[model samples]
Target: MTDLDAALSDINASAEEDVYVPFEAPEQSELDQKINQYFEGVVVRKDLVKAVRGNAVVPGYVLEYLLGQYAASDDEATIQEGIDTVRSILAEHYVHRNMHMAVKSLIREKGRFRVIDRVTVSLNEKDDVYEASFENLQITKVVIDPDTVKANEKLLVGGVWCICDIEYVHNDSPGSVPWQLGSLKAIQIAGVDFDSYYQGRRSFSTDEWIDLLVQSIGLNPEQFTSRGKLIALTRLVPFVERNYNLVELGPKGTGKSHTFSEFSPNGALISGGEVTVAKLFVNNASGKIGLVGYWDCVAFDEFAANRKTDQNLVNIMKNYMANKVFNRGNIQLGAEASMAFIGNTSHTVPHMLKNSDLFDELPDSYRDSAWLDRIHHYIPGWEVSPIRSEMFSDGYGFVVDYLAEVLRSKRSEDFSDKYKAYFTLDSTVSTRDQDGIRKTFSGLMKLIHPNGEATEDEVRDLLEYSIEGRKRVKDQILRIDATMRDSPVRFRYSDQAGTWHEVTTVEERQYPQLYPRSWNAEAADASGSDLETYAPPIVNPDAASSRSVRSVAPPLPIVPQGGGAAVIPDDDEPLFEGIRDFKAGQKGVSYENLLLPYLVGATKIQIIDPYVRAWHQGRNLGDLIGLLALAKDPADEIEVTLVTGETDKPHQKHDQLLMLKSLKDAADAVGVVLRISLDNAKHDRSIATDQGWRILLGKGLDIWEKPSNPIADARQEFRQIKSDTTFTYARIPVS
Candidate 1:
């Protein structure tokens, strides 16, 4: 048998006998193996268990007790047996929808059996009187006297988990009856110590831990796509970072809410439009604590597009995000709980960038500069496509509960300095900008390159991407309000002798067809181009003094081309000659189809997209790399470099270098190279022949769909390959 088959067979054999012997088995006992097998690879159904067990909202152990039943073994018979046992336990002991009836039945049938329930109780120890309140069964204000019970004697009250008090009644009867009693153990259930659990499981590597989690959830890790793996990894970030505020705004049906609602005990999901200041922080009247106080991470589901939020609350949230301190009745308190906000966007990326920005649709309160500035990162929700059923994995992973705790313990460390040695940010950046950029940089750095050993280019790329992400937020604000000044966080050079340049956004450099102002209007207009005239309006300095009516220029006419821009069809296309020969000049297949299949395994790909040195091309290069990553295998190694002209900013080169470094590191983890080469050549777009076997043409690295409102679907149906675009492929003969 093959090595993989042998391994699988051994694993199956061990599992058949109710034992699991990992390749690197520790000194674990048979029971440990059984417990691991039971909990590993099973996703706990939190809502179902919560619905069944009333009165007490017990922690995850209760649900784990259930998952352990359904996911005990790989064997169907063994798993069925475990499920039967679990079902019996729940049916016999757990309170149901009719909690009062269920509790009553339990008390009558079992007589004195112990039960689990949430109870709120008040104690007057000195007076020997106590009052108890139950939530699920609706029992409230039940008074009990302690004097009737023996001093310091513990009694199981009502066969339920509780702390109570009892007192003797002076009556002319055969025996003294209990007059008063109190209980305190209402919230206490059989909770596994989280710290101990995490500590015990900390020895496993991240991959191993992730595998364990996937296995515990009963999903194989190998079946998941790269993006799927990333989505899964994101779930663990909350657990890894203390107070790690994460926002994943992606397409619908990506299972964004699954981890928060069903994965672990430490997480809670608050539905959209249901969050209030009191619920998030502290309630004044009842002195009841909020979600932040109770849960390690509070995820706001469907958090986007709420227009009716309170301004005061938004302001308070800004403070909380910036300082981690929120005010409660003139008191500022700190919390280590992380926050997550998820929402869906109605518009596509290109449309959003063209007309507004990612944050444009947000409510005015949330749109405040201070509030937006405090958000550490803004995930490109549109880029994360809807999850397909096929994306789930079949490999092993850690239980969600175990993974969450690992993330929690890892938050104290920072991995930012690993990149600091090779590169540095431009000095012109502000603290707010720096904070936004650095927080994102640091968070991602912590996530992947936690040891801070990332190369110079790796650090540079991440910094640039982080800066660009934050810029996407800032740029939209500008479109919404022209009064907002441009941010000074330019990606410039730190060295005395600058060798590189910067590109702030994709619109600034490439897609001159979209940005008329940046386009060379003379050249474009001379080609019988339908390009609109984009002359800057001359402002009359004295108009304000006399209130004179200024003459307005007539609207520029749009001359539409017959079939878009003219293209000179090549008779001798040497670039694609090699590809045509390999495919035997297949008539029906386009260049994209011919070349894309071979490009899938490439380790590094280079694209040369240059504009004015520091303004646009850098971003174009970065975006190209991102696209290549989408097409390539997640584990395949690759790198991309952009060769462009020098820019005017003294620090632009440094910023570009740093950006490249960050990208390199991110790519390295996922198997890609990110780099930049400076060249002053004016007109050239060619993919390096040495990096791989094929080259792309027609905007080389800048191919993008036309901007559309409400964003067109990303599926292959709506978008077709550019017919005029040229591509070349050549086989690099094996040495």
Candidate 2:
């Protein structure tokens, strides 16, 4: 029997002996319980990997594969026993590079031993035989048969982590190899039943499934917003979506390469310069296939500006990424490998948007419009949080190997047209743009609604998100190539109700001044259509001008009104009085930006928020007071009154008062008079200024989540908005 067959048989034998019973945790979350109930044997506690992976440099799939075997149960005794077993196995059999001599000595003494090491095989032309090399053992020329190599072809490319059985034999004859490969099984899920996976998905709501999937990928779902969760999942699209080209550029340490490098065995992540046409597509001299033929996804890391790139490789890649085919000599070959490029951006999004296009950081050769257009989606990696200690999940999640297998099996299914039932893309969208949208929509549906069960709103959300991603790519392309401006692409969609929603990237809304004015003019000319727009008031970057005008668009919920230039108002004029919406996960928002412009002339301001009882709430109140101090003339003292709810507990109220007293002292130091009142009867939150404008706050001053690091959040824009908020301005009589 084959090694893989033997491994599957062993697993099946174990399954027969101990049929899986749904694990019941004593105090589990609803999502965790659902994950365990639907996929008991395939789920493992994510924290356990760190506990057992003391100094090991192995990927998560390798460690989780072992953990899933022994630690899948929720019972403490079983989990403990499993952890012990896994620890013992790794301690004894797992090969460490520094201790290879000891393992070799053990194998020689015992005549045969099993070791967990990465094994790579290559054809030795002179010997006319297939030879295997052990990664950690520092050994080569071990003979492996053709049948074994055929069964596991991945051993030829980047190598596969495996449980290997090796034997040492004394050799007296010349040219006789002493090392023997008895058996080898690649560390991966042997099989996945798609039917069971689909049925299991049916048991989960979309939100629950998204959380479960995020947890499986080793992230804390609670730390991410719904939009953030979708962006994170987009990284996995290349794995499940065939020939999908995705690029993510942002600051480092955002886990951009984590999914490709560690989440799945079916993916290969190499440095940008390490790739070549021969290594990626085909070797003309040897007639050997390359990485694309073996892996489902080929990802390039550190794919930023100023890297040396070969023109031939770029030309070949352009064709392969566009058509999924490349010419090797006289033969045309096709590969299903998706392409992912992840790099760090040297500048912030606004800087890039202002100085050059978003693709400005790419190497000169790759920044070509033809090459950039093939990208299916462009992820705004800046929106993703940097990896923090608390971001890693400790709860139960699918064993990554099982999840990988599920993603791989789904490539054959198509949900590309699912969005068409509810919405239609704008005619201005090109065929290529439509293709990118459909593929992204298909991949997201396969992930969130694999059973093809979704409400119209859910489908619309996915469709719009897909359009925004592709639109981000197109919008940047227009900036990079002036020639493309002749045929402008408008990213909009129409629902069955005949209402059009214009989709804009969150960054676009946040920095309207940085966006290209030419495209905004074209969009304005087309504004005759029924559209819903959520355009934030444009702020002039010139600090000398305190007056800014809001972009006028037809008011709607989801669709964007066409863009227009901001009409700069006089410095003495009041700021535009309108409602401004901020989405959750949006950054660059502060009390100074949201309200200070309107509070310019007010000497007295009354803030009414009933929920300011917590420590963070008090901090928010202090921040607003500081903004008020900035708004008032230095010669004039401003009076700020805060009306907030008080806790019933005596100790809590005492602590709150102490915090408020400290804030008052700080306010007094800045020439601001602070008055505090306990008001449990107030239900609404607003800021009333003596300057004739009343600003209604949907979420009050507590708009941001508690920052991971308060000092950093203040110095840098690291905190994301926790709640979707709106600031509605009403003209009240001057107090």
Candidate 3:
């Protein structure tokens, strides 16, 4: 075992309860391991059988019944024997309907046998009888006396779970019609008492609870990295929060719906298109309550596409989401149901941010401000990539049913006050606007920092991210409805005199460079009268010639063709040469090597780039910091300033500040003295580090492709570099 595994094992072993086990490979494949893990320790035999089947599209309880008859064991031999026995039972007595003769023969020969099937029932009170029906047997109108019905009411009826027995009663003569009398055994099958189980395990720490949950899902936590575990845990937040609406829009095959549908009885997951007003709210005709009234959380699967939703339904849903109540033919009912809307996105994050805001392709009705306002949090689904086989955990976690209750009960506690003393919102922000934002911010804080002792920087980060989520909703609504006024959402420092600033969505302030023409207003303004007065585009003949030439040309002679020998330019001035044909480690041409000369004694550097406002932009600065760390400095402090646009809002400013903080922290750790500043100047791509060191840049910060997979390698990759791929730097200086 690795050091991490050994450490985890030691921790688990020391726990009050057995929380983890050393990684052990099952005799079967990984798929089999999952099945065994789900069923091995469960008390119910039927559940074991169903888990082994692994989602074959059968009624869950029916599979459970089969599992109960077989495979309820930790022993491999017994499980194999049970599997064979269960298969034999299915082949012998279970009717497939297509094989009519086989079913008839089994009924006749077996005389009396138990078969798992769907059954329908109708009460015939007038006749003092109850009629039982079976689909597979093609049997209907079988009657049971009152006493027998009471005893066997739980038998299968149509799609419901029930237990019944058929008795053939001969009437008066041989060859006469035979009457079948079936007895109802029971009405509803009881699920495991999850509430009691949850209460029993409530005292476990969050990490312990997560481990138990992972084990309940039949995954080995060891297979997943810490970050992977956190991502998976984030999926559980919806279950833990009451009336908490969560939307996860990421790439497909991420197991987004697995926890809701398979892990708990309190949750329900329906297809995105299947949702209707009546199904979600109340049935007007019969007063039959819908999913929202029954399930704690109803997740809408595949809820992303713009074209696949009903406009009218979306309107009613908007109100339902906001008030937690819906109107159905004048009858109103309140519900505490939390909604989860999960979907798949076709475009990358940067691409989507450039084209439109995060909620760009949502249906018209769902795009309403009233509805979007109710959504507490917006998970950056794209940040969560598709699930791989390696991401599952081998560690133990709580059964989801238990965790759901913990979150529901903890709803009464508030954590927003944790930041009240340290920071505040800009005065222009309203209370109504802060409700949703603060609630979500507080909920996350409670989950992560329950004691309310989070540091100032941590509080600031969560607050900014939380505000950005709400801002995404509000901004999109403004685009849809011109009448909607902009909400003043900003964060401020309570102790500082002038720290308050307006918050803006990352898409609105930082994505212009990647998609310059997509912003409707900005594009319109630039395309109008401003174009004529704007400066003309500059071109370099040397750059143009380099693109056209296929082979390298020899250097020209010092002597001119019609004059005295030309004087070679002095190399004293640092010449910023943009590495057109640059590759890493070509003698002294790497990024690290190039920056060493400037660090020694160079002064007065200028960097011009338009896309350096985002998190990725901060990474470029980080890289420069690393290069500077290599320079020899004991008594000297290098002063570096940046030239870039001011971010459109305070949140962007916050992001920039955080980026600088990281740099500062790293520099301090290594004892490096560096000072950096930002400047707003319009110019072509170039940088002048120190006097006379000039570099002409191509593509500026908008070069390089985003890495396809971040977890694969460390170096020469975007993830390893700790910055966005939206930047490339070159050196240049004035002659």
Ordered from best to worst TM-score, the candidate numbers read 2, 1, 3
RMSD of 2: 15.4
Top lDDT prediction, candidate number: 2
Candidate 3 local Cα displacement, residue 270, angstroms: 1.4
- The residue-by-residue lDDT of candidate 2 on 480-557, one tens digit each, is 887887877779999999999989988777656565436446764544221223233233322222454232211222
Which digits, one per residue and each the tens of the lDDT, describe model 1 over residues 1-735? 112224334544543452222222124334334435544444332223323333334444445545444543444455445545555555555444466665654444544444344444445455455555554544544464454222212221212233332222335656333232333332222334544544434444555544555544434455765444544555555655556556666555556776676555566677768878887877776554566765567788888856678776777677777787877777778876777778866544433444545675676677676676666556655444344334443333343454454445557776545445655667766676666666666666655454454556667766676666565555444445545544333544352245544536544343243333213234345333322422222222222122122212121111223435423323222223332211222123322333333444445556555542442334444444544555543323455555554444655644544444444444433334444555556356656534345454434543334323332222211233333454454545434
On TM-score, the candidate that comes out on top is: 2
Screening candidate 2 with a backbone cut-off below 3 angstroms (N, C-alpha, C), the clashing residue pairs are 501-559, 502-559, 502-560, 532-559, 533-561
Model 1 is weakest, by summed lDDT over 10 consecutive residues, at 549-558
Tens digit per residue, CA lDDT, model 3, 1-735: 112224334443443241222223244434334434543433222224332443233343344445444544556576567656655655554555676455555555755545544565557557656677666766676765656544443332213333445544447865433436444443222345445544434444445444444554545555654444544555555555556666677655567777666654456778877887777877687565677776667898878764666677777777777677887677787877778888876544444543445566566566666677667766666445444435554322333333344555656677766667667776745564576567667766655554455667777766776666665555555545555543323333343444664555554443333322223344436434221222221211122112211112222113333567644323233323333333222221223433333333443445666556677666765666555543422222345545555466754555554455455445433324334444455546656665445555554643333434653222223322222222232433345
lDDT of model number 3: 0.51
Question: Is candidate 1 or 2 superior in lDDT?
Answer: 2
Q: Is candidate 1 or candidate 2 better by TM-score?
A: 2
lDDT of each: 0.48, 0.80, 0.51
Query: Model 3: which ten-residue window has the lowest total lDDT?
Result: 544-553
Work out the TM-score per prediction.
0.52, 0.71, 0.51
